[model samples]
Target: MKKRLLALCATFFVAFSVPAFAQGTVISIEPGDGVQEALQEALILAEPGSVIELAAGRYDFTGPLSLDIANITVRGAGMNETVLSFTNQTTGSEGLLITAGGARIESLAVEDTPGDGIKAKGVDTVTFKDVRVEWTRGPHAENGAYGLYPVESKNVLIDGCVVKGASDAGIYVGQSQQIIVRNSRAELNVAGIEIENSYFADVYDNVATHNTGGILVFDLPNLPQMGGHSVKVFRNTVVANDTPNFAPPGNVVATVPMGTGIMIMANREVEVFENDLSDNASTNILLVAYPRDYNDPTYNPLPRAVYVHDNKHGRAGFAPDKAVKDIIAPITGLPVPQVVWDGAVDGFWSAFFGPDAEDAIYIREPMGTTFANLQMVKDMILPWGASPDFDIDDYDGSVPSREPVSLPQDQ
Candidate 1:
């Protein structure tokens, strides 16, 4: 009887110990049949601070995956090793939609989504690291809109990510504050890395190449968040962005001219410095006003207090395209200036009152770096031929440097 009881106790101990060991803080998920269901279930049922470990394998998902739980991590073995393929996805928009705060998604590849890849919306303290979102078909109009998209989120950090073949913008952060996007590569997209309608952003150390437009800082009208200001774009390599715009009609990025290096529109207090801009056929840098008509009284259509300094420009503006080819290059001549700014200001009232001292375009560059201010508003009102201003000395002052954006995740 004693021996039998001891044996039973040993069996009980073994049975419970195996389960306890398996049910630890980390939830390991293997890729196989029913992977979608298993991942979705794990995302839904995971407790706070739980780590959902995705093993190194290809996961074939037929629908979108969402995580609504806060303070959970979804980590894969490696970006290239662990693949999440949504090629045949028939439901939902994004490949993965994260709606919860304190979410960290790292080391995974999302491929061939019809809509977007890995979108974090309305969350706080989100981090996307070492992830790759790619459309293997190359740049096409039917490709997804954005890759590594974080919108309406605060304290966002996107680091060491690669996004390719997006129809719209790759590595897009919209309506987010306190954002830092660094060490990323965006290629074969309409706009490589765009900071749209966001405040207090630092975009640096990224490679923006082979896209239609390399980097765009734009503030459009009629968004939940407006008044984009205090953005610093520095230390980026924006080069050879000569891809034709493949964005579908009626998209905002469709208006971006091909071969644009860095375009800024309708934002205030922006600083562009220490970038390597080379081989962009349209222009190295373009500063323009909002081209469309809008009824938003709260919106300011003119870019103000912009500072562009200390950038290395090479072989740009040789072959302009789109509206720049049709209108701007004709006035500014072939091989349009490396820096092109449409001299647009508030209104007719500004002709007499003059622009405020704070709302000025400042450029401090090397001696031979070319520039042109198209005087667009003046020509529209006066119409006495296209009198483009090629003198860079008129705009030679600096604005106060903005403080670097600090995110909680970087710490």
Candidate 2:
């Protein structure tokens, strides 16, 4: 009797503990399969490392589809085919709120939420691929917060997503690291794509057009971690975004007459390169105030260590002679020759000023000091040369197309 009792206890322990050691299981959800039933079954039976596959249909959650399961993969038919929508979400409610790490929601469309479309909080290894998120609530305050808001998340990849009509921001990834946003389009929103308080991010080959502000990298204040540093915002096409009533209020930066293209604020060790920026209402790119309170615990300074090169912008608001003066010197408060190419200064002097008068700009530092790199000045600001767009050997048809360049990666 004693031996039998001991054996029974061991059997019970094995039966319970075996499930814990096993990997998560896969659960499938289909229209014909009863959506709520499958979801319920998954919630009940799913372990860690589970996958929940959904068929093509519109799923309206009577309540939130909150997944307590960790390391689960949710796959859908496609963005167009499968739709997960919420009509009535109260404050701070998301269409899909992912709290678990290593979770993925791919190839679906989520819309019409009270708060954010998808909010991934404190999760790691999250990926949203080919997903579409929109705030159908018009442009009012009732509109949802962000298309994708990943705060304090890591290794997040938001690729090929069409984010539209968010009252706040289309793609807002804040306080995250190793984030990659590629080939995404953000339109008809307050701010297009915002990567703030992030590091080691690569935002490439995206189109942020016709938003209030297009393609913003900011290290905003009033945050615990306040450095938007070591980012590569390259090869994006930003244009004609500054239609009024869409831009944010109380913004000190005005849209350039042509609209604002790329606005970099208080970020450090950043590189902005090989982008097509034009038709902004005010300026193509604005280097706004950096976060002044990051350096010391009390008072961090704005981002330093910035490199801007080989970008192509329309000549609507920017003139040949004043290109460097207006764009570079004003922000740096440095001399003329410090920013522009050597050829550009020589060419500007030749066309606008005689030899004696041309030399005067160098000596007097009208703004503050002489310009740098006369050749680049000639190439950039000088008139009647090959158009900056077409002159480059790898210039591909005024717009970004399939044609490759020598340094395709550089652009």
Candidate 3:
């Protein structure tokens, strides 16, 4: 991938008429005392197709640093050796912001920011490898909302990274396309990893623990984008995400229950398989509605065509909290099934066209893994004393696999 990125930049100059962006030129910044000034100067003077390398050291800054030049690579000696702390950041809401295409940021650490650690918006072919974004004060309400936030971007790849101590989500990808987030670790956040309102995503080979919710795939209303679908989440270790929800009020993630292994809400065609989810106090896997009133005509609040299969579940669904305790536990009892569905749907039509609608959450887990469909919609209907049909067989089918995301080589 490195060679491919390099070759793409090399071919860009030859294909175009830009010559000032010379090849074989590297800009090195070793700021000993004047860290902010050196970085600001480097960012302003950097040309396209150039590499901005920072030497191994600790640097403190008071504002955000952003790059707008295309085909730029910002690298450091190592994640631990080269640290950038934004404890006193006062200007921008993000520690490092990128608005350029074909940008590669690698091997660095960003700590203690007021807002987001690294926020890249509306960029294409942006990659973050071996990067660490953390809040050293540890999970406080004043901590950054997100460690790594990429929104409205295309061909995004985040690999081999560690993010922690976020008030909202450790790693959040929102309203993006063709995304891949793998081989990463997220801990001590409201949500470990959240893929929201996105399409064509593959999230796998990641570790999510010690947070409010291990992983979340949510689709909410009132966004630039709506009706996100076709995401694959598999082959991950999610356990012991029992952190308190410290997010500020009105944020979507603030409602996430502590000790949730994984929650899938208001999305379609999401396949979750081959994950090890255990030791979560609340629930192993949860499928529910959007849990709000919305008027968006395009936003579908029901989760449809979801396939959950072949996962290893251990010691989950014991201790409940918040809504799970007040509404779900009394219906399903403690140690709530291995998989719990809120049984929320789109009114009377759901039952009238029940098995044929294919609007279902499918599960094929191993034996001894309990399952429950809470039949939440029946509360408004008459004769609700008897349980509505919670048959697992009614919601059984296979969803097609989504195509793997592949970034454009030419950017």
lDDT of each: 0.89, 0.60, 0.83
Writing each residue's lDDT as its tens digit, candidate 3 over 1-411 gives 244333322331221232433462466666455667667766766777777777788888998999888888888888887889999889899999999988888899999999899998999978888899999988899998999899999888989889999999999999988888999999999999999999878899999999999999999898998787888889999999888888887999998888888899998889899999998888989988999888888789877888998899999878876677787888888887778888777777664445234666788887777788877776556474436444666666676676777777323
Report residue 305 deviation for candidate 1 (angstroms): 0.7
Candidate 2: where is the Cα deviation over 4 Å? Answer: 1-24, 31-45, 243-258, 290-301, 315-411
Which of candidates 1 and 3 reaches a greater TM-score? 1
Using TM-score as the measure, the top candidate is 1
Ten contiguous residues with the weakest lDDT in model 3: 9-18
Instruction: Output the TM-score of candidate 2.
Output: 0.67
Off by more than 4 A, model 3: 1-24, 352-358, 385-394, 409-411
Q: Write down the worst ten-residue block by lDDT for model 1.
A: 8-17
RMSD of 3: 5.8
Q: Write the per-residue lDDT of candidate 1 for residues 350-378, one digit (tens) a residue.
A: 53343587888899977888999887877
- In model 1, the runs with Cα more than 4 Å from the true position are 1-24, 349-354, 383-386
TM-score of each: 0.93, 0.67, 0.91
Better of 2 and 3 by lDDT: 3
Clashes per model (N, Cα, C within 3 A): 0, 43, 0
Worst 10 residues of 2 by lDDT: 388-397
Per-residue error for 270 in candidate 2, Å, reads: 0.9
